[model samples]
Target: MSFLLEFVRDPLTVGAITPSGAALARVATAAVPRTGSPVVVELGPGTGAFTEAIQRRLAGRGLHIAVEVNPRFAQHLGALHPGVDVVTADATDLAAVLARRGISQADVVVSGLPWAAFAEHRQRDVLRAVVAALPPHGVFTTFAYLHSRWLPPARRLLTSLRARFDEVVVSRTEWANVPPALVYYCRRPVTEAP
Candidate 1:
């Protein structure tokens, strides 16, 4: 918990809480694409909270790729989620990493990343890269602290998402979370908007 808090220290990052409870993981994992053994990519899976949920959902099927910027978390994830492919890289470089892994497209992208903390350009870079790497009907799930606008920072992130993703669905909020949070389940449109 302390490690996560330190990583997500910025108000915009919203990584303060471990949010590692089983129930929370269930909700986050449930939001993934239904396709069996689909290629799923996870960002900033600190200490493997979301990573654990994802492995459970995979049910011994599918490839789980996790990107962690923190060397400590990456090392820990490597040891913990043996089923998952842990990549020590920045989220903004998702496309390159995926390409290197021979991953043409992802079925779902689950992010524990502190998006709101990133500069506008960096956020756009990551979002655009992720979207480009997703197949049609792919899903993107992320969380934000509901009590504070820091997680997604409504005005900033909402606009960027609207422009990048086909549709953005706000899933049930996990008020049980330490700081209370909302999950955003985004999907690629059947066709890109003009």
Candidate 2:
């Protein structure tokens, strides 16, 4: 917790106080379908907060790969979440990381990345990697704080997401969360990628 607090000092980077609560976690996990032996990927699992949530959601069904950029946090996550494959890697390099792990596509992708902090190109890059890593019917669930419920960028991002995925859903809003957030759940489009 201390490490997270220290790292998240940058409002844009960290984006919130402590990690999300159980309610939000539940929504994030439930956004994806729990297929038999499915492959799950978590991006930017800071301090293993969301990692723990994802673990409970998987219920030991499939492979859960946690990709974190922070080496210290990665090590901490490895020790904290024993079953998770805690890899120190960038979220934008999902394809390369999956290849090294012999994973072709993911059944679900849950992101705890601070999207508001990322640049436009970075956001596109991250989404591209995530989409490329997902199989047909795969789901991606991500959350952003509701600091400004009427922010223009948030709407723009949602619009962009709709263009790429088929079922773009906004999961339950977590008003009790540290900063009050909303989870966006999306499913892969059936149409072949253009």
**Which candidate ranks first by lDDT, i.e. highest?**
2
Clashing pairs in 2: none
Q: Which runs in model 1 stand beyond 4 Å of their true positions?
A: 1-5, 8-14, 17-20, 33-35, 150-152, 189-194
* TM-score for candidate 1, residues paired by index: 0.86
| Reference-based TM-score of each model | 0.86, 0.89
Model 1 C-alpha lDDT per residue in residues 105-127, reported as the tens digit of each score: 88888888776567777777777
- Shift in Å, residue 36, candidate 2: 1.0
How does each model score on lDDT? 0.75, 0.78
Error at 17, model 2, angstroms: 3.1
Model 1 / residue 76 / CA error / Å: 0.5
Lowest summed lDDT across 10 adjacent residues in model 2 is found at 6-15
The residue-level lDDT of candidate 1 at 37 comes to 73
